[model samples]
Target: MSSHVYVAFDLGAESGRAVAGIYDGQKLELKTLHRFPNTPLRLPDALTWNVLRQYAEILQGIALAV
Candidate 1:
C-alpha cells in the first residue's frame, strides 16, 4: 500500500497553525506541525497584525514539514 501526505495552514484572528495529514488509502491522520499567536500591535490610533513574525512562523512550519 501507498500513502499520501498533505499540508494545511489554518489562520485565524488570534492564532495560526500548520497541520499535516497522512492518508493510507482508507483513513486520514492529522498532526499539528507548528502553531503561533497572531498578535496585533496596539498603536495610538490603530492595530495591525505582526506580518513579519507571521511570515517567519510560516517558514518555520515549512521547515518542520521538510
Candidate 2:
C-alpha cells in the first residue's frame, strides 16, 4: 500500500504553524514546517489582530512549506 501524507496549518491565538505529517499503518508522525507570530495589537481603546499581516504570514508559511 501507499503511504499517507498530510499537511496542516494550525492557527492559534498567539501564533500559527505549518505541519507535515506521515501516517503509518498504526501511527502518525508529524513535523513542523514553519511558525510565525500572531500576537494581537493592543491599543488604548481596543485590541485587534492584523488580519492582512496574518494572511501574509500564512502565505509565507505556505511558501516555506513548499
The number of the candidate with the highest lDDT is 1
Task: Please list the residue runs of candidate 1 whose C-alpha ends up more than 4 Å from where it truly belongs after superposition.
Answer: none
List per-candidate RMSD values in Å.
1.5, 2.5
Q: Once model 1 is optimally superposed onto the true structure by TM-score, how far is the C-alpha of residue 62 displaced, in angstroms? A: 1.2
| TM-score quality measure for candidate 1 | 0.81
For each candidate, give its TM-score against the true structure: 0.81, 0.65
Q: What is the alpha-carbon lDDT for the whole of candidate 1?
A: 0.90
lDDT of 2 by residue, 1-66 (tens): 566877788888998888878787788898888888888988899999878888888787667656
Local error of candidate 2 at 62, Å?
1.0
After superposition, which runs of candidate 2 have C-alpha atoms over 4 Å from their true positions? 1-5, 22-28
